[model samples]
Target: MPPKLSPSGALRFETEEHTLCGLCRTPYKSCECKGLKDNLHDWYVWHGVPSTMIPSAKDRIFVGLPPPPDNSSRTKLVKRWVSLVNISMIMGHFDANHWFSTKWESLNASMDARTKLLNEMVADYVAQLPTNTELTVLARVLGLQRRAIAGKVDGIAKEAWAALRIFLSGDWACMSKAGSKLLMNAFNTRDPKKYPRDDPHLERILDSGVSRIYGVMEMGFDKKGYCLAMEPGRRPCGVGTSTTLETSDERLISKKARKRKTTKESIPTKKRRRVES
Candidate 1:
């Protein structure tokens, strides 16, 4: 038969050696058991936990009280998580172009006039660019340009408008200080005399160059036409003899003749019939 267990809660053990204090595992009150218990009691006291298992009304009330409100760190973490989820959902709809056409159309209909204006500015900026630029260059340029523009505008509202335009444009390219400074200065000044009136034209040039740079950057294309940017040495200039001959009339005829012979072998001749309905 199994040995009868001790009646003490959480203290029952199978062996005599294990019959020591459940908490300290030392001989009950004798050894360091009492010291350990006193230390635990002091800890509970410091932490505001009741020393006794049974509670007074005050103890009960304290125990029943909810925890204090979350601190800013906790709140910030929660917000970050929510933001990440929202961003992931948004990213699901966008393509390589960084646009969700359907979402954009719906938004365009509902958005305010300021929002519409910002979107148009971005669209026009992107439209001004040719398809050949590197993407990295475009991203950097766009960010720099936007910052410059925002710095010029005094009000937070105007800066926000400028920022929205940059985001929508999807132009990320590295730009020189000269170009960036020029844009920043122009954006901040409202006076016609201080700033050039030809903003639309200037904006177009900036936007297109930025977009092309971004595309090239993304493709890892060098300043030269070579695919890899880091590689040195000039790429061959003209079409090679092998490439030209491959597209010549003789090559085309031979390919066509081979296809025809293959098709003839695959199919059987059939008798022609008169159409009498």
Candidate 2:
């Protein structure tokens, strides 16, 4: 089937053929075949997403699910979620062993290492903020404000705040939820100072070691495996299942199929006669 063309005129195809022009198979434009031939130099260049679809600064901050990942978009919602969760865990003092003891002590060590790495990342972000910018300006103007203004932020902020209140009320049972929220809020906030000094943000800093541990755990396992560990029989382990396949069984199946196909094709056809041999 002919590949669909994106609004920008870039052909989008599921197969590799789209990499070449539709009219001609050649990578270069010299093989022109009408509509596919113009300015081939610029053809290879990808036209990114339209600016109208792009989320403004005001779009990211206040509250809602982030937009889908796109080539034109600078931030990835999943990566941001992962980073925020890890940071919150670290600041909350969650134990690495609790999540990864089944894996290895070394895994726990690696988790600590990752948390430190994320801390450095947060530090870099914090450092980049202009010292001259007022704390209030920084707080109100952060990514959250942009998202809030743009109407792209999720309703999760209210839930997060509710969880935070529970944590502040001295309920350790709500710690996990609160920590998660703190991380989410941090990513959403333009000003880090808005994160409560005594609890929310401080918890993230304090639990940095643990967050690193969790980050390592997350990185060590694929999504399926991680889900399996979390939900057990409800989800299968992605890595464990892939590794369990027997090569001998696979080879036997392939051999039998090939033999059957060859036997079927070997059924003879009548030969043609030569009159003047």
Candidate 3:
């Protein structure tokens, strides 16, 4: 007799480590494991999944870099997508000759205004994507630039660009520490104001270079982990916790005060000695 099914419809099978297929739970002697595995492989292949892709951890679903964020690959895919979109957007603006210095108040105001406009546009475009569209299709569509042809192609290109922008923004919402650092490094190394010439470091170079264009560095994360780029000068940001945000200035001031107190208490006062001729 066949084993009974659970209330959830899962098959209850006799598990034998040496004899049964873990997934379909069939006995090895007569198992169709090869067919099942091949079917799975084929499905992924059809879907254009990379062989190197592995199942992400449950915590990864929550988003952002893992706690330490240093030298970690646990959230590489999302980070990579976000980074790519960021670089592309920066370069795109430069290509359009929208050059602005971060130090300029007028430019900062304009950046904020443009960000809001772009985000709204991106959302509208993402909503236009067909519900049945596959993730691979969405990714590829977002990667491509819109054609400049008049009418139909132009309309479609605008939508695609918007979708790409939306996707990038969504991924960025869960920015990890590593992701934040990666972006900062990319901006610092790539901006003409910072490098002005070709970067020598290969790894840094990989993050740098978005053409001959120079742009402002409005976005960044403070030590408290706030995205200064988006919000700009807002302070007293909270970290990963849900608690009340504290002023970063206060935090820095307190640290400085404590250091001064410690130095006054710990170090012996140096005595000035008169040099005998």
Candidate 4:
């Protein structure tokens, strides 16, 4: 039951005091049927039913849910009911906390604070790269490779925790029934064989939040805790999650040719067995 749009004539709130919403039967000033969600889809799903219909858990999820604590930063603030234990926790809770909703605005403020000095440092480092000019690279170097294959996982234990956390949380709604079932089994049994590693992309999903060749490899809703394309190494993921309607790369190895030519100082010799003492 979507928000009932009266066919004939909807009740007009003429700034009248104590005017109850015609749909929810609650005061127009405070309509619970409108729901606590920020988006229309959630409202349609959870609060669409009229006041006459019995409200389910979806309708009552935010009835007593507390918001994030007052703090300058999410990292510093202790988590509340918004743990990654369940995906439904995202609604009316995670966004209100500022961890995922307005993270970019906060990050941008921090970037502006030190961009000038940081750029100066980056440029200075870039100049130091061996055979600095790109034109010279056409001769000696074969090709540049991303650290993807060679990179090491940041922390194996933490990576597993993060992957399992996402799968457990209600975020699996978007996934197919079969896929979700498989993920559930893999997580539940704690068996690597249960995972569909042959999928190839499975590795990246499990490695979410762990460091890759670039920054944190990601596959979910701001799992890195924030989203920003700060460097060529790191890029933003959940682009549209932000509430605001916003208007808003590196070099390779370095080496220097030895100035003085030197002769071989040492030679390798095969070890001889001492048969006789």
Return the TM-score for each candidate structure. Answer: 0.15, 0.20, 0.19, 0.18
* Residue range with the least summed lDDT across 10 consecutive positions in model 2: 55-64
Cα lDDT tens digits for candidate 2, 2-47: 5443333122233322122211122211223332122222322344
What's model 1's lDDT at 81? Answer: 19
**lDDT, residue 126, candidate 4:** 30
Q: Where is model 1 more than 4 Å wrong at Cα? A: 1-113, 131-136, 139-277
Deviation in angstroms for 66 in model 3? 13
lDDT of each: 0.26, 0.28, 0.28, 0.24
Model 1 Cα displacement at 142 (Å)? 10
Candidate 1 per-residue lDDT over residues 19-138, each given as its tens digit = 222222222222232333432455446768665531111100000111112221222222221222222211112232322222333332323323344344444433333331432343
Q: Is candidate 1 or candidate 3 better by TM-score?
A: 3
Winner on TM-score between 1 and 4 is: 4
Question: Could you tell me which residue pairs clash in candidate 4?
Answer: 1-48, 86-170, 87-169, 87-170, 130-254
Candidate 3: lDDT over CA atoms?
Answer: 0.28
Whole-structure CA lDDT of model 1: 0.26
The model with the greater TM-score, 2 or 3, is 2
lDDT of 4 by residue, 1-277 (tens): 1222122211112222312222222222334444323333454467565534432211111111122222213222112222221223223332424433344334334434433432333333233333224313211221222222212111111222222222222122111211222232233333345444453334433332112211211212221111111111111112221121110001111122111100100111111112211
Per-candidate total of colliding backbone pairs:
25, 28, 5, 5
